[model samples]
Target: MAEQHAAGAEGIHPTNDPGTPGGSVDPQSGADSAAPTRRARRGGSRKSQKATGGWGAVREIAIVVVLALLIAFVAKTFLIRGYYIPSGSMEQTLELDDRIFVNVLGARTGHIDRGDIVVFDDTQGWLPEAPAARTNPVRQGLEFVGLLPDSSQQALVKRVIGVGGDHVTCCDASGKVSVNGKALDEPYLYPGAAPSDFPFDVTVPEGKFFVLGDHRNASADSRYHIETGTQFVSEQDVVGTAFVTAWPLDRFRFLHNPEDVFADVPAPARP
Candidate 1:
């Protein structure tokens, strides 16, 4: 009977002992199985963490690049700009091939004044060339991106001769132009060229302006437009008043309004 019972026990299979040596399970075998399972779980957790951190770093980098591009676009649109002179109309003040920086912000708020050398679109009346080269669609699009060609395509730089409502006339007895019946003693006029040799008497239209160049003889400015059959450049045509000479390191200077003479000129009486 005892031999039969032992034989029966040997035939029965051990149900849950995967780490057993010979089917008779030991506590050490179970402990060994636990170790491998714990190790695998730890390894998987570490790999997941490393992948998550790497992706997070990549996402941050992409966001920074996008922000930088947006800022560049905004600045190119309306704050400041670079301009290139393509003509010698403003010679001795601005030269050909000269790259200049313009402040578009200040001009937007009516801060432009007399004697300021301004850059404006010559689409209508100011361009000297025949078949005037106005701002074409392509150039207009490029202007927004700050990538316009390094040449003025129907743009000009000239000083504001008379503002909104000043009566401007040329060549007084002393050969000086007068604003509001007062002689303008201009110190910046080109050497040896009178304020204006040609004669003109016009009241500046409301919300309009009269502009001229410092270099009189060489410049074909308001005087020429009046002499020729072209409309005067109104304030609507003025782009922005120039405030600086940003070319030829030696000629750089701040262009302040020539206020000493016009300061005393009383505002024209309302008609």
Candidate 2:
């Protein structure tokens, strides 16, 4: 209290008021009385402004973060989504544990082309029923917002061999798979793996697709589901087209459809 009073006193300026009966001055110290209350109010106001500014900055940062997350979620839901390869079924093309970005819009008719890898839901019990995934809240939240790939999804990635109304068969005269009478010289197949270990010939029904894995021998794709007669995967069940190998920086690369492999093949005949 003593120090504050002395400090205020030292800051006082000498003044004389004409309205006073006699502009009397203090004999010891000549100065106007210091307004300590006003000074203290100004000091408190500065501190309050500083605190409000800090909170405002924080609020702005929070809004930006929320907007970014919303954009990611929208993209994941309708434009693109991320997934992690969990099996060797697509080996050599998509290695096990590789992360990939899938184009959700590409699942539409005519967008998904032959030789393009795709991710699809296992709708018809293609995959054995597994218990619900148990994940931590943090990791689950990240996946929900598209910051992390959802590796727990019950989905499969395979190459599109034939789409809607096309004839797809395995082991042509040259032991290669054929679509619409053109043999596929698949260089993406797993090393030492045949085009297909089993033979199958079928015309994909309208709005359905015949898919196979790059590692032919090890994959139980459309061919392995024949016993149920639901060998063809419906177009409606496709999640998206896997268009990149995204994880393990050393393996980062855009996934392109082997269009050249299907270019020479004629389109399916329309009835």
Candidate 3:
């Protein structure tokens, strides 16, 4: 009976350790299993960081682009704007399809003087209908931001010949246009082109301007609109003065106002 009790005690106190080789559990196996899980977690964290970094770069680029567009919009609206010349009306000074920069501030301040080349809106029915052209939203947006030339259909460019209350007439004995009795020495006229092909005599009304094109013979400017009572463009319709030729790099130059041409003329006679 004592021998049986001794055997039972030995069975209850078995000496094989669980973590040893050939035992039920191996500590090294558990460590190896856990190592794969840890590697998988590390790889997932790296991928997540990479994705986040890519998105951050895209967001920064978007912000920079938006800021640049906003600055261009403001400059085009109030400070300076570009215009595309569609006709040869102001030839020898500005050519067809030439891009020009206009000073909006000068026009707004009423700094426009005689002999200055100006762009004006066709408030009256002075301009003929324009031919159709293809356009898309993308092009329109570029034009609005001043990245492209202005595409306004009713804009005209001309030289100021007379201001408010000034007497303007064509064809003196020397075949020259006269302003306030002083014949103008117009060197800017197209070669061999007369100041005017026909005779005209009129007094510029208050707050209006008498304008003519440098290419007088080819241009149907104020003269053509005289019979329709749209002879003069109002000061309010002036957009700005073309101060610089921007495109066709070879022909680029600052536009001079030719103040000497109007130096001898007197101011408008007030009633």
Instruction: Please give, for residues 102-206, the per-residue lDDT of candidate 1 as tens digits.
Output: 777767767766667777777665655756447877776565456663245467788887777788897789888988888888887766777776888877777
Most lDDT-accurate candidate:
3
Q: Please give, for residues 1-271, the per-residue lDDT of candidate 2 as tens digits.
A: 4535655677543346443221234557754233444567689999999999999999999999999999988898889988888899988999999999999987864487788798988888888887877789988888998787664767888999999889988878889999998898988999999998878899999888899999988898999988789788888889999888889899999999888999899989888
* CA lDDT of each prediction against the hidden true structure: 0.70, 0.84, 0.84
- What's the TM-score of each model vs. the native? 0.69, 0.83, 0.80
**Candidate no. 2 TM-score:** 0.83
- The reply for model 1, stretches above 4 Å from the true place, is 1-65, 128-142, 147-153, 227-231
| lDDT of model 3, residue 102 | 90
As for TM-score, the candidate ahead, 1 or 2, is 2
For TM-score, candidate 1 versus 3, the one ahead is: 3
C-alpha lDDT of candidate 2 relative to the true structure: 0.84
